[model samples]
Target: MRNHKYLFLFTIFFFLLGFMNIHFSLFGIVCMTLPIILVLKDRKKTWCQNYCPRASLYTTCGKSKKWSSHKTPRFFIKGNMKWIMLAYFGISLTIILMSTLGVARGVKLPMEYLRFLIVIPLPFDMPQLFDIMNIAPWLTHLSYRFYSMMMTTTFLGLILAMVYKPRTWCTICPIATVSDVILKK
Candidate 1:
């Protein structure tokens, strides 16, 4: 029942805020990110062990203890950690790049779709694109609020990730949450 509840939450529209940069306002992003930290801090594997698709992938790829046929690796905690970390980082960077490029190019998804991207604390200076691309949106300038919000949330998220685990962001990340639902079941 809990799994179904999580799966359902992942599939819903509002929770999609985790995927985008401008969805639920800045405060909303923190609300979503906090739960992920709590979940990963659970040393008992309550979250990833039962819920993460990437976790399943790691196990199947012989990168996780759950799939090592009961024989654990010597560096169980540290072994191959970088690879997993890199893979997760790469995916995140790709998604952000693609979404930013898409939005900057005037690629219009539904407002709801944009909500997901908006909720994430996007790290890049999106407004700078106007000057860099030589585009003309001479009306509204990037507000101090935008950068402040972005930096604050992104910095907190990173600090949490570094202090806890490398891919701490992915734990409750809407993108990862969605992908896990799509691929795991």
Candidate 2:
């Protein structure tokens, strides 16, 4: 891990690898899943504080903005927004799984492109990088969906960091919400 000297590389690989072989996007699933597992076992935000590569990227990028010293907005810090984000995360994950299952069972659900908020498809296109392999189409679909979800969250985090403060997006991060609810941290 380069003794953690280059943490953003962890985050960048998911985005870049998918361009070469979309199946590499499946790594997003492990990143998505690990925080929950760590929180459940340790009852801590160790993942958010230390292991999250996107947080690393956001912090480095946000600090570069210089004008990002503004207070985090009330909507991101107060009330139900964090819970709402968690709900959106949950729903999007469910849709990804169910859609994959449908395709595995021979249903012809449309493959996801780069989605913005999980439901809204964005205009960017990806090569069908998995077509050369004989794997089931659902694997490729799942890979793309996971990549889109990761990108969507990373984009939101970067925007929040730019407009307010470095790591400000952590206030409403879905996994942070989960940790707070579970560990009261």
Candidate 3:
């Protein structure tokens, strides 16, 4: 707790900022990218160990013997699940990019249909929020889709943390996995 207190505070600040405006949602990008940056700086897994808001919160909640019931499943810790998750993310990103570009090119795509797959809706309509802020509609749509993706990933991570080890999801996190891979090269 002592080691992670500052990260916990920053996480709260980021969450509040996210609710206040769509632009602040770029914090998600920073969170996703930081692992890789740390790896490049030769501080591999620093974000997961010391800085990730979600990981820190999970540790506080589940680190105690009473809270953590089961050992993380072998498959989750040592099997192909991480690659599967990464592939899912890849497919989702491809769909989002294609859908956004389709909209930009005046080709109608059913974006609402994709949104239905998101486990949780964002707190606000990001496109509408951007409109109120006088930002471009296309960029708003892109950001909205990205935020939806982030929400889905966060929800999945929460479920995994509750069911398994505190940092079970971190083991298979795309960013963390990629960072480790890159740093091993």
Candidate 4:
């Protein structure tokens, strides 16, 4: 079994990936992030190292054992991971902002449906339940909104991984795939 810390971070990220908007209600985010907060006093790579699927996939891709030591020219660290993260996040955020604004202005772009699909909840039926309950509409709206952000971010991250390192996000991802694999081996 993995440590609680791993579960803690993964739960939050999974929750965000699945349900980010719920704006007016902190219930979901709170319920999800609580464990991470509790474990913050003794933070570790418990989450990223053992339980994350993304990390597992990357590890399966067969990286060089010394890949982390391969330094980029302008970096202080021996690894090129930092630059990859920076580029991915920067481009992702920029694209999200521009795409969102364009959508609001009725402009068309490729993968525009993804913008809607990402922000919207998965299973496609739960948000409507909130509407039936007459709960906060912002919660439903925000859930959809944040997902758009995450999709853009994750997509950009994936693209940057191709250009930079093989698994840049997995390197610092707060999930537990790595730790579990090492222990099991």
Task: Give the whole-model CA lDDT for all candidates, comma-separated.
Answer: 0.37, 0.81, 0.66, 0.42
How close to the true structure is residue 57 of candidate 3, measured as C-alpha lDDT? 61
The sequence of per-residue lDDT tens digits that candidate 2 reaches over residues 20-125 is 7888888777886798899888877778767788888877888788573777778888878898889999999999899999888887664857788877888778
TM-score of each: 0.25, 0.89, 0.78, 0.40
Q: Number of clashes in every candidate structure?
A: 9, 0, 0, 22
Model 2, 86: alpha-carbon shift in Å?
0.7
Q: What residue runs in model 3 are displaced by over 4 Å at the alpha carbon?
A: 1-3, 12-15, 63-68, 109-132
Best of the two (2, 3) by lDDT: 2
Residue 121 in model 4: lDDT? 34
Candidate 4: stretches off by over 4 Å:
1-35, 38-41, 57-135, 170-185
Global fold similarity of model 1 (TM-score)? 0.25
Q: Give RMSD to native, each candidate.
A: 14.5, 2.7, 3.6, 10.4
lDDT of 1: 0.37
lDDT of 4 by residue, 32-150 (tens): 24435434533554434345444443333324344442332344234554555556445644555565465555563323122532344334432322323553433344444555554
1 or 3, greater by lDDT:
3
What would you estimate as the lDDT of candidate 3?
A: 0.66
